[model samples]
Target: MDALFILTMLVVICALAFDFINGFHDTANAIATSVSTKALKPRHAIILAGVMNFAGAMTFTGVAKTITTDIIDPTKLEAGSLFILAALLAAIAWNLITWYYGIPSSSSHAIIGAIAGAGITAAGFGALKAEGFIKILKALIISPLLAFVIGFILYSIFKVVFKNFNLTKTNRNFRFIQIATAALQSFTHGTNDAQKAMGIITMALIAANYQQSTDIQLWVQVSCALAMGLGTSVGGWRIIKTVGGKIMKIRPVNGVAADLTGAAVIFGASYIHLPVSTTHVISSSILGVGSAHRLKGVKWGTAQRMVITWFITLPISGTLAAIIYYILNLFF
Candidate 1:
């Protein structure tokens, strides 16, 4: 096989691998609230999340197309397959590092930053498509803030509405409600997160001249969805613990509120074909709900630590990608 074809294959594998890791990493966020609230048993939650994620992944290609054509044009990238490969490698490395440490970092940021970094390294700063890049950054920054606001407001309303109700009965009712919300959250997670890998694969196809245009092929979608589904089954216990319990003591009511808030923000972003970090949105939702429910109950220390990690992920992943690109370029 020609070098280009081989490189394309490598990109496809790496992209799917990224999706798989993303599934377990972020799927934890989708189901953490439910599991923590005892709304679903851990095994049941994983199964539900895996199925929902697959269903959601197959539902949209708009975000994938955005990732493919935006950031930096695959059409204009020379030897771009190498850049993408380095990006995939860097993103995977960052994700694994965070996963090992149980930090709920953004896989979306890692890949996007890696792509930008690799592209910049290959062709300098001019390689970036400024408008699209800025738009994505806005979505990433704004979604978590939106999630926080919605979560705070929603839980405040819940408190007022259920104030007169029996506490035990209310928790029971909300626990049942959390089951549905968990599925919705996972579905929404699938809609946004799975598309990133799809975009990466499409970029590879274009860069290698295997395909033209930003349209995602059916096989690519199916493969990515399956990879993610399988990954979800593995579960991300460490990150799950941080998001589910360390952020706050999540009651069923609190879980439902956070779940609804995260689902709304994520689905809204997916509707507009924007990629946002599921980890950030979900974690922020919990923090918001905790603050609304009881300010002192919120773990500001843990929140501060997670926030610091979030701010650093972009630059760190980008720099790491640039470094990997140079090293990979040396070999190929």
Candidate 2:
């Protein structure tokens, strides 16, 4: 095979690797509450989540289009294999690093940041579409807050509605309800997160002259979804422990509320083709539920640390990608 063909294969593999990392890293988002409440076993919850995530990927194509056409300037995407490989390598590296530490970092942001960094390094700032970046920035800023508000309102309503009911009955009902909420969360996860990998793979194919537009082929979509589902099945137990047991002690009621709120926000973002962080949405939802009871219910220090990490994710990934791209350019 020629050098170009080898590089194209490398880029595709790296894109799938990033998808796998995303699955494991974000598994905590869908399963944490159910696991913490003992509504499902850790292993069972992941299996359910993985299956739903795969199903969700088959349901939409809008978000994939947005990433391909809007995020970066397609015209500036030089027909080259080395550049695609460097960008995918940067994204995969950052994802693995964050996953090892059990950080629920934004995989979508990491990939987008990688593309932007590599694009800039290759052809200067003109290669980026500032408007697309702004849309992503807006989603990143607003989606979590929207989820928090929804969670607070929904949980408050749930509390009031069940006030006169027997506590035992209410708890039992919530446990059942959590199953549906978890499924919804998983569905939204598939719709949003899996498409991100599809977008990257499409972009890579376009960069390598294997395609003209950023549209994802059916095979690309299926492969991306399957990779993520398999990764989720393996379970990111450390992150699941942190999200489910460490952040707050979740009751069935809280679990349902958080999942429902997260699903709403994520689904809404996916509808608009904005790649928001499922991790951020669910974390904020959990915070909302905890704070709604009383401010003291939240572990402020742990939350503070997560918030700091959230603030730093894009810039750190962007810098990492830039350096990787610079170094790879020399060798290639």
Candidate 3:
């Protein structure tokens, strides 16, 4: 077999693996609140999320394009396959580590940082497209903060609008409404997160001379969607526990607000072809809602830990990717 062919296959397999892990790892982002609030049974919520996520993945390719060309040009990098493989390994490691710990870290941050680290290590600072990389970084940083503000404002509005209603009746009504919002949030997650793997696979194709245009092939899209959907079926119970309950005692009204904010922010990023952290956005939305509900009700300790993970993930993943690239280059 041709060496490039073997490496390309490896990239595809690893990329899909990353996508699979992403699905289970971030599944909590979509269905956590609904499950916590008893708005949807856990089994039903996962089923809904899996189907909606697949549908959402099939609907967009713009973010895939960004992942293909923005951070580093696959065509220009030296030993590009090794670079991508190292990135996948590093990202997958970070993801599994965080998921095991039940930490709501950013998968978006992990993959992006790993790619950047590997690229720079393989080809130096010049390998990066400063303009596009910076743009992506900004989106990652800003979106969660934006979600915080949006969630805060939306919940505030909800409080005033429903303040006159009977509490029990309102909670009962919002529990039903949360079902729809949870599905929307999951769909939005598919629109953005699944594309990361698609982008990685497309970049591998380009680097290995198996493909030309940055346009995502039909096979790539379907495969990524299936990988994510299948992974979603497995469910990440640890994450569900952390995000659904640890962040705050999620009420139906709070869940609805957070779901709306997360969906809006993720979909907005997808439309613009920017990748943002769904984990960060969803968690922040919940935090925002908690703050709105009552300042003290939000568990500051758990939120603080998650925030610390977000800040550290990028640099650590990048460094790991760089080290992994160096080691892989020794063999491949």
C-alpha lDDT (0 to 100) for residue 247 of candidate 2:
70
Runs in model 3 with CA error above 4 Å? none
259-300: candidate 3 lDDT, tens digit per residue: 999999999999999999999999999999999899999889
Question: Taking the tens digit of each residue's C-alpha lDDT, what string does model 1 give over 18-122?
Answer: 999998888999999999888999999999999999999999988998999889886777888999999999999999999999999999999999999999999
lDDT of each: 0.94, 0.82, 0.95
lDDT of 3 at 257: 98
Q: Report the Cα RMSD per candidate.
A: 0.6, 1.4, 0.7
Model 3 lDDT, residue 290, Cα: 91
Q: Sort by lDDT, best first.
A: 3, 1, 2
* TM-score of model 1 vs. true structure: 0.99
Q: Compute each candidate's TM-score over C-alphas.
A: 0.99, 0.96, 0.99
Query: C-alpha displacement of 320 in model 2, angstroms?
Result: 0.7
List, residue by residue over 1-332, the lDDT tens digit for candidate 2: 97667777887788788888888888667988998888888778898999999999888877887777676765565634565566677778877887788777777777777777777777788878889888888998899999888888888998898779887888788888888889889989999999987887777677667889666799999998999899889888777877786677789998998999999999999998888889899999998888786678788777887788788777877777778877877766
Candidate 3 accuracy as lDDT: 0.95
